[model samples]
Target chain A: MSDLADLYRDVVLDHARTPHGFGLRDGAAAESHQLNPTCGDEVTVRLHLGPEGAIEGISWEGHGCAISQSSASILADLAPGDSPEQLRSRIAGFRAMMRSRGEVEGDEALLGDAVVFQSASRYVARVKCAMLAWVAVEDALLKLG
Target chain B: MSSIAPTIAAATALEESEVYRLREDFPILREQMGGHPLVYLDSAATAQRPVQVLDAEREFLTHLNAAVHRGAHTLAAEATEVFEQARETVAGFIGARPDEVVWTSNATEALNLVAYALSNASAGRGGPEADRFRLGPGDEIVATEMEHHANLIPWQELAARTGATLRIIHLDDEGALRLGEAAEVIGERTRLVAFAHVSNVLGTVNPVEHLVSLAHAAGALVVLDACQSAPHRPLEVKALGVDFAAFSGHKMLGPNGIGVLYGRAELLNALPPFLTGGSMITTVTLERAEFLPAPQRFEAGTQKVSQAIALAEAVRYLQRVGLERIEARESQLAVRLHSGVASLPGIRVLGPGLGVERAGLVSVVVDGVHAHDVGQYLDDAGIAVRVGHHCAQPLHRRYGVTATTRASTYLYTTEAEVDAFLERLAGVRGFFGAAS
Candidate 1:
């Protein structure tokens, strides 16, 4: 059980169990369903942005493994309150981290809850699981915009 | 069967053992993955290559390799004979006559050929069955949600081209398609019924005979996605009586780049050639050219000479073990996998849960843990299982889940592997502290 912690870390599971802002908003600007067809992981992310293009709130309700759900949980907090431009930059940084083969060099703290999965770089398969919610949110935001 | 240690339970496990020993013929299984003995639970992706099959292809390329259906030279004659022989072996494996097996690049190409040929027929290029196979606005193509993208996409593209509507027989809560509703959906307007012989994602085996009969009653043709079923189970395609059947060789311990497209002679003769080029001609003139008869008309240019030979050898390996026994072994593996996961506290086994209904594969979702983490956990322990949608998106949407973790087995898998897999999965929730 060598730090089974790295693979299933407490921070990751906490967010998965108690995902922040994890519910569908009543009036959403746009909703998008993205599926990673390889292992059957699916997530339907809904975006509710303020009139000024700030992410008012974002939520997801779908089925996936803990990494994905927890990743979604972490994403919920970061999504709302940011201006569209800042949010877009975060998406770029996150995408770069995800697609990076190894060594996501950045302020790990800024990613907040997503930092728990920093060790995910070692496992390629789980990276998609971690990225599914993030990708869905980005895709939903873009589609909503 | 002769040298291998017999299974613990014969009548129950023997049938699967037949397939298991058959798996021994595949050489790659002897290798390791992730520094651990590869308990490959991912045969549904692409099976490992057997030694004999590998050698056969090697031997062909070294000595007898040449272009087929061409040349007056000695090597060409030898190459042509060997290539045709592989076709005969493929035909025999599917229980079809040699003339009926049309070799394509792979199953996808085979299906595209069928759809395009039908489209041509609707456009008045077909010989006899032209009107019979034609699709229009009034016509319908019915399939189940369990179709792999290979089967579903071609029909979808075909439906878009012709004015035909694509209909479906939805699945029940267990991820099994309601076959009875097939009778209802496959009616007069149903021009063709396309479905997977086995659900690639769910591991649910469809009733080919009943579906075929239903389609025939409505005067519609049936095409089978034998990609999953043909490799793992025993198939008598002729008896299955589909109008056209498509399956790739790569999934069956054979080489890539070759696939078997089994169609009835009468229907095949009526269908036009999908690919146009050298080697598929009867007479050529400056103005126009006449195409040769199928399986050659569909196989234009140079065929996968060595791969076809290797695939033929793969068929021989399976035959030696026997399809009946292979199907049985996989069924037992499926049952064990299903029960093991079903018993887990937060686990919900997808598709046809525990039964002979599922063909040696199980997809499940845990309450608290994510499938990817579970997959990562398993991979650490030297277990390899496919996680995510398994390529049937509609099936996932229907199940009301974005994805499910799938552990699929073949004859090569052992009970120890299944037990170890289940054990690791059981620990996932607790390790994450997400256990309720």
Candidate 2:
């Protein structure tokens, strides 16, 4: 269906193939490992903070479906240069979009490439896949706090 | 090595027309998925219920609904008689005495019952009667790497509680159990051997008789996880010489919330009850309560009465169709399933290789495409399959993968359905741009 195309857009596929900040890095402020027990997908996200506690870098490594891998890559791409508060707001926005169940169009300004997951939100099972990395990053931020 | 006589001689595969006719019995087959006819190939997860099973449950609830074994009224008498008859039917289906069959919520609970009962016995709950079931330091429990978590975790807990070591019978690269390792592992100190008759993920049927002989020689009890085999093949627990077995009803075209646990009558009567309350005891005082015999001792609280009746009807349906014929038909599908997927480039079929006589299911790993993506593509095409660790995380780890796409078949599964699944699966890699 067209919705399937929407879920796996060209940008998402590109990110999944060659994800940004794909490897776990050293000298991080905090790191968190999250597993999606339903499908055995997992991710370990490392967060790097600037001197003023702004988000400097986010790196992650994991194995999972395209949705999860691409979502992680997109999160890593958008998380830089934002404060922990800004990143938390982004996380909340992405979570709200996922929970919308196709009813709400995501804010492209806030979610950026992550808005492509709006189609994935229609699939109840795949919502977790899109959120796996975001949850890991959230956990990492909590650890930093 | 089975002592029970075969129900039928070797038979030819069911005709395509006959399979089509049988498919009519499942109303869900008529439903459409993603604007296409539903091609159900996930029977290993849970088989679609036939009309007979649905009617059996509704019929019982409409006419014979009553609390069984407690009331003395006419309705209660009728309900109890029907309930016991259902037990007899299930018992006969598995080649066990009626008294040896215990009703559980599902196979998980059934396995837990035995595990917790043994733990209770080890804690001196059943006194000297359950001495044979007790395990302490120096005792061992053996399980295989390919077991579903339901069968594996209970034994892990059992060993953790009793201080008995938990050993594993590793699998070969082909996904079959290594009987040599099993022989070495199941030695004198082994108190119990727990394994699945067929791997839920790999679909490789384990060597029941060989493992049974090994456990028997070690003077250890055998607990067979028959969840995968009982629905596809003729399972004679007594003939297999297993001391205990567990299987779910939903996987066999029966209703959910009902499962059967088969144990030797003497062994069941001796073990302490896991869930103690009303309907399972002989008498009770403020401080202590005496439990009843075998099946009743294990059945506590309100039972899944209607579900059990429906499961019996499901068993009767299988019997009437003849398990040998179903088995024969499924074997042909298994070959087709294995070869069809194996022939595809970059597709690695798990479990037995081509011509290796696996059960009627095939799980495969598409080289570059993740199983979830493959599963989603197939789902869009209205082809249902199971994709994940399939509750055997260790087996997946052994294979060096996190998940796999599994297509399983049953009596109602047609050749066209299997082909449809494969055709959709063949396109998954190309769609995902992972075609190598």
By lDDT, who's the top model here? 2
Task: Evaluate residue B315 in candidate 2 and report its C-alpha lDDT on the 0 to 100 scale.
Answer: 94
> Where in model 2 is the C-alpha error above 4 Å?
B1-10
The digit string of per-residue lDDT tens for model 1 on B1-436 reads: 1122234333645543444565576666666766777777887877788789889999999998777778889999999998888888888888788889998889989888898988888877756656666778988998778787778888898999999999999999777678778878999899899998888888878888999999999999999999988887667787898989999998888888988899998888778777888988899999877777777777888888898899999888877666666677778778888888878898888777564478878888777666776777777777888876777778878877766778888767778789988988888777767677
Query: What is the overall TM-score of model 2 with all chains considered together?
Result: 0.98
Query: Which ranges of candidate 1 are over 4 A from the true structure?
Result: A1-4, A24-63, A75-93, A132-145, B1-27, B127-129, B174-176, B285-287, B353-356
Model 2, B160-192: lDDT tens digits are 998999999999998889988888999999999
Classified by CAPRI criteria, candidate 1 counts as medium
DockQ of each: 0.52, 0.85
TM-scores for all predictions:
0.88, 0.98
**DockQ leader:** 2
Best by TM-score: 2
